[model samples]
Target: MRLLWPSLAVVLLLYPALAEEHNYQLAGPAPGSIRFKWIHGSICAATNRDPRVQAVMYNEDTYILRENIAIHYDAPFTYLLMGNKGALLVDTGATEEAEYYPLRATVDAILKRWGDLRGKTDLPLTVVLTSPEYLSENQGYRQFVNRPNTTLVPLDLAKMKAFYGLTDSWPNGTGRIDLGGRIITVIPTPGAHKDGVTFYDSYNGFLLTGHLLFPGRVMISNDADYVASLTRLKEFSAQHPVKWVLGSQIDMKFLPGVEYMRLIRYKPDEHLLQLEPTALQEALATATRMLGKPEVAILADFTMRNRVGPDERPGRRPANLPRIPQLPNLR
Candidate 1:
């Protein structure tokens, strides 16, 4: 696998923002048409030119929005929705005006495509943000404010209260959203990203995973709760059998410096979908590797890199740790 030197170097320096926050914008074109740029690399290239953005249309109706937004680091904002009921949007693109150009237009195009639902007069539409990144950074959401009954659903209730305006509820775990007649089930998976989550469309076994399960990447996880959240999906899939593995971002070649601009869809049953089981096993193993190993230093290093102004990343440590003696055993 090719490694992103800048990303890895930033990681080595332990910059929290490099992993958590993205700083980039759209490069070319207008709404309905867009190309993203790697702001970091653009400045470093000898040509001092923007990196060519690759756009991959996952399908006619299903779009990986990140395909249109600048990729700052490893992950990109991804959205997935089928009609209104089974709408499973992954990540909200960036939080800036430049990045919002295509993101807002793409969302409008999606809503317009699903205009058949006659009940739009009432029961307004709810755009669910699987995690905070989808909502916090993406200022484009402001465009949806005019829509009737438009509400933003987040994962953390306290954060929802602090930032989001429309809806004040944070998804605790598994919850159901009645999108008119459409159904969206939110499954909280908090490991890879803080308060990160995924949504399963009960209507069609379509699993819209954000940064949780990016194709060809070792789900960079550390926090135990997030790992536990991912484990829950393994158990759920064992019972429910996810038919489709729809990801936000994917690079088929796994080559370095080759950015992916498309969503990779895998039809398990159709293609003998056994890869998920293997992938799930690997994800868990990675999480287990962190167990008993103190991650405070990693967290501290990440914070130092971000130049976190004042507020520190907040969350309680998992209670289940092996108790070690205060001093060496006297034998």
Candidate 2:
């Protein structure tokens, strides 16, 4: 880190605006276009030809990469943010085989090109997971192991808390990472997954919530914990302006209160991945109202249901578990 400081200082002298807060005009090309059409998987896997990983340059300093749905059903979205001194990677996608997935190769290519373009080389890379509990989201982590100048944060909750400086006020206060001048704030949002977290990019006002607040089925194990996490998110959003709520997956369809069948490779009428900032407030309200409801609350943007557990069915449940209805077909 210290080795890159001199170069960063030189760049700062040339660009004085970055010395203060650097406000980036978030999107690239237009309001909707993001490099290439998102390759929502094919109906049949045998003929699928989409790249194992699809990347879109959100901006010069930011890139959004989604694993091809054909390669993995989850096809989680991984984010790469470039800073003057270093770079930050959010989550690694599912697939593990290099011949099939090649996540690290793809990322290396992107970084090399970006470094050449910016005349910066060997910028330290830091990789962090949204939630270590999700296996598919972190499966591709081996691609980064022993890689030069990279740090893959461990999956242990204790280690993560210590690394992010949230040991004292975990799941309550915030932690941060300074990627050079850009500081991304980290908030604990554990409900859908106990180790869940949401990251806020200070430059673009993008709130990257992994599974907690996506536009899909948000399965909750503990309703009170989920509600409390949502409250924390709501309070944080009140203080910080959020531009986009980006989730890892988009299972919900265009139809309100409906999601695509689980493990379906193809989704033609899928809902948009990016949700408006108002979504946070809306989600909080809906979750609060469904705190003790017996039905699976389905909203236009998202559906709230209980995770698959012994007491997850439609019948009577313990006071702690949220009332959830029966499961549906397909998804």
- What TM-score against the true fold does each predicted structure earn? 0.54, 0.83
- In terms of lDDT, the poorest run of 10 residues in model 2 is 24-33
Which tens-of-lDDT digit does each residue in 1-331 have in candidate 1? Answer: 3568877887856733221121111231112212333222322234433322332344433455542223333234455544433344445554445342455456555655444332222324456555565443344455555655456654465654343332334334466665434456667666655656677765445566665654533234445665677678778777764655554444322222122223222211111111343455555655566564533211100111022222233245334423333787889
Runs in model 2 with CA error above 4 Å? 1-36, 292-294, 307-331
Encode model 2's per-residue lDDT on 1-331: one tens digit a residue: 9879999999977864422233343342112335345789898977899888888888778889999888888778999988767899998888878888888988999998888667777879999888888776788888899999999878899998888899899889899888887788999888888888899887777889988888877787667778898898778888777778998888778765666777879987778888888888888887787776654656677766754532233333234323347578875
Q: lDDT of candidate 2?
A: 0.79
Please give the RMSD to the true structure for each candidate, in Å: 19.1, 9.0
- The TM-score between candidate 2 and the true structure equals 0.83
